[model samples]
Target chain A: MPILEVKNLNVSFKTIDGVVQAVNNVSFNVEHGEVLGIVGESGSGKSQSVLAIMGLLASNATVTGSIKFLGQELVGVNTKALNKVRGNKLSIIFQDPMTSLNPYLTIKSQMTEVLMLHKGMSKHDAVIESIRMLDFVGIPEAKERIGLYPHEFSGGMRQRVMIAMALLCRPELLIADEPTTALDVTVQAQILKILRDLQTEFKMSIILITHDMGVVANACDRVNVMYAGQLMESGSLDNIFYEPQHPYTQALLASIPSLEHEVERLATIPGEPPNLLALPDGCVFQGRCHKVHQECKGGDVVVQDFGAGRFMKCNLMQNLTNGINQGITSNVVVN
Target chain B: MEKLLEIKDLKVYFELKRSLLGKKRIVYAVDNVSFDVYKGETLGIVGESGCGKSTLARSLVGLNDITDGNVVFLGKDNLAKADSKRWHALRQEIQFIFQDPVASLNPRMTVAEIIAEPLNVYYPKMKDEEVLAKVLDMMHLVGLSDNQINRYPQEFSGGQCQRIGIARALVLNPKLIICDESVSALDVSIKAQIINLLKDLQKKLSLTVIFISHDLSVVKHICDRVLVMYLGNIMELATKEVIYKNHHHPYTQALLAAVPSANPKVEKHKHVKPLEGELPSPLHPPQGCVFSTRCPLADDGCKSARPELRYMDDGALVACFKA
Candidate 1:
């Protein structure tokens, strides 16, 4: 069984203007010991889907559908019961470590508190475990540095501390939301390497949410492309990178400047993302999609299964399938 | 190519707070950096944060005080020594597009007002109708609609706001425009749009640009020549092809290696060892090479003596003995 399964997850926020549908019918699963990447532009509801799973949404927000972990339904579960699982079996690392960590608390107090609360360990034992975890994440002199406040550490070091804290309980599933976005490229590379190594060492599943395609290519085994509030496509890493069927996914991949080759001009999808509150009647990406057709102008576009764990929500699938199949065969031959 | 701007031994220093012993320490932000930007070319300056790339850009526009250096614009005007009146005149030719789009723009001002602010200041005698026509022309050039001219910055999306920023920078028809990480804060698709617009504008206006960004991929896409800096020192200066293909400096190689490849196949097979260690505090940078502390090929020679930037056989300039 998969480590986590999200089925038709929808998240909406009630504001003064109206209801903002942040996430709409998003579904995906993270396999055991595999890294799943959720790629999207900002306001695409990628972060909200994970926030809903952790029960960390705002008070005015509403979440529907199901989030199951280890065959257990997490939606509508009481806060007390959810708390037992959160930060214990499932842990999260946010984008900015400075804001997520308490400024007033020392690293020792923050880390040991998690152990003492979740594992019921004594304070003395918690300190030892915390140091070991910090050491595992490559923080030199973890024993000495644990007493320092979060402000004392640099950006990269603070991110390492955040990772160590997230893995304090050796979580079965880890959700990292742009953990390295605030870091330099070299520091980002180091943090990613540490995460990759630790994920293997602990045999833990990871959900890496990012807007960077390079990061997704480097770290993820499977990719889910989100547009607006919907899942445009979902497949394995190779499938998503080399054979993207959805127009949004294709445009996104084409738009990013590549390190390997230089293009004269980057292909861009013109127009801003649609306002979620007053979304158009049909497909979420119809407004900006290059391959948008007549069928996408009206009625809801449903997710179509293409076997071998590939799924996409688009009306042009019937026309694209044969061409993509041939491309896949050619890709295999080239490989 | 004509030399649009020439920087000679530019250095910017900041004095730190006095120690408890009442001793003053100086931070060498831009330490003896010299380079030339050619006319009608996009020269990309890339480095990690705190590497003095932005400081170099600011020094050109007189935003940062030069501790010791010469900024010669058009081979005649030494901007560093220019008087206030001369500085005011030069500001019309060298405009800057800041990193943050929203924060850089005033919320109280409308888009038309924001774009016209430069014209009103530089060309005070121009009529309001002429200013409005110029502002509308710039807005149309940057792909913003005329109707949105009355809207404030908060009303537009990030990409549109960036267009306004670009329009403002272009209104004066500056000979040299400096973009300091202008697209770093944007999304991929929007970033691409802004990049394309900048390219088209550059071609149309024949503008000289100094593009400073930490994103190497974006730099590679838009820049004609690339300059790599480390700890306030120029590590490498070369054409984009040489920088990407035949890079000599160890720091340049490490910086390139650190960029994650967009292709999964390339990323999987990448064999270059990732760089180790973090940037040391600039307040007390290493004596020899700024990157010597983290360099994999560092030895006694590298640790003891600083390497001067020298021309290589491939026509690229590198500043490492090992290279």
Candidate 2:
């Protein structure tokens, strides 16, 4: 069984304007010791679906369906029950580490708080453990740095502190939401390298939520592409990159400027993501999908199984995969 | 091609007030950087945060004071010596597209009003009707519709707000447009649209652009020449082909290597030489090479003297003792 399975999960928010469906029937599974990437652009439900699973939704938001971890149901659980799981077995690090951390609290206090609360470790022991985790995450002078406030460290160091704090309890699953987006390229590479290494050492599953395809390529073992509150495609990294059936997936691939090749013009998916409050019938991606067809606007779009555990929600998947069916022969799986 | 702008040893330093106990200091935001921008070409300036790429671009428009050196625009005026009156005139030819489109524009101003603001300043003598006509024309050029003319900036999406930004920049009919991470905030699809729009406008108006961005892939796509900077120093300056294909500086190489490619196949096999440590504080940069602290190739000699930006055999100017 997968470590985490989210089935038919939907998230909607209540606003003055109307009820906005932020995540629509999104489902995916993360296996043990795997890196899963939830990829999408802004306004996509990539973050919302995970937030729903973590029980971190806004007060006005409503979440439905099932989120299971280790054969245990997590959906609709009370705050106390969810808290036992969060920051213990499952932890999350947000986009901006600076905001995620309290500006007034010292790193030692913040990190030791998690260890004491979760592990029931003594204050003295917790401090030592916190420094060890900080050292593991490559923070130089971890013992000395732990006494300083969040503002004392640089952007990259602050992220490391966040990572160290998240791993203090040694959680089995870590949901890093755009962890490196705020960082520079060199720092991004360093942070990603550390994350990859720590994942192996801790044997943890990670759900990396990001909009950058390059990040998805670098870190994810399995990939899920979301658009306007819907899971467009889910597959192994190799399958998604090599044999994408959904037009949204294909368009996103073409949209990113390639480092390996230069093109005169980039292939852009025209039109904006659908407004959640007033999403159209049939397909949510119909407006932007380059290969959109008449059937896409007719009725409900169906998710098609392409075998190899790959699934995609698209009306034209049949014709789209006619040329390349089944087995991916030339798969170069990214680390 | 004509040399539109020649920057000679451009420096922008901010003086810090003396503390009660400590001595006064200066932060070299942009330190003795020099480069030339050709007419009808897009020159890309790429660096990480605090590298002074934005400061360099801002100095061209007199947004920041130049502590030293000269900016020769159109091979005539030395902008470093230009007073406020001369700067007011220089602003007519050189316009800036800021990083955040939504914040850069006034939230209360309608799209039409925002676009017409530049025209009001540059062409103050023009009639109101003519200004409206020019604003509408710019709106059409930048892909905004007539209906959005009365809509405020808050109502538009990020891409549309950026379109409004471009319209404002173009309304002046400037010879040069400095886009400072203009498309960095937009989604990929929207970024593509903005990039294509900029390309089209550059050709149509024969406009020279100094595009500043951290993303190298975007820089590679839009720029004819590229300048790499670190610690307010120009590390390398070359044509796109030379910079991307034949970079000599280790800092530049590390930057290119760090960019995670979208291609899974390429990423799987690609070797990323992760740069050691973080970018040192600009206020206390290494005594010798700016990059020597983190450079894999740095030796004792690299820690003794800063390398000058000198021309190489490959027609590229690189700042490294080994290069």
Provide the TM-score for each candidate, comma-separated.
Answer: 0.97, 0.97
Tens-place lDDT digits, model 1, residues B1-323: 79999989988999989999999888889999888999999999999999999988898888888899898999999988987899899999999999899999999999989999999998999999999999999999999888998999999888899999999999999999999999998999899999999989999999999999999999999999999999999999999999999899989888999899889999899877778889898899998988999999999999889999999998898999998
TM-score (C-alpha, index-matched) for candidate 1: 0.97
lDDT per residue (tens digit) for residues A167-280 in model 2: 988898999999999999999999999999989999999999999999988888989999999998888888788777677887778777887899887777777888999999
Per-residue lDDT, model 2, residue A155, is 95
lDDT of 2: 0.89
Return the number of clashes found in candidate 1. 0
Q: Write one digit per residue (lDDT tens) for candidate 2, span B1-323.
A: 79999999999999888778888777889999988999999999999999999999999998889999999999998899999999889888899999898999999999989999988887789999999999999999988888889999999999999999999988888899999999999998788888888988998999999999999999999999999999999999999999999999999999999999887788889886689789888778799998999999999999989999999999899999988
For residue A327, give model 2's deviation from the true position in Å.
Answer: 15
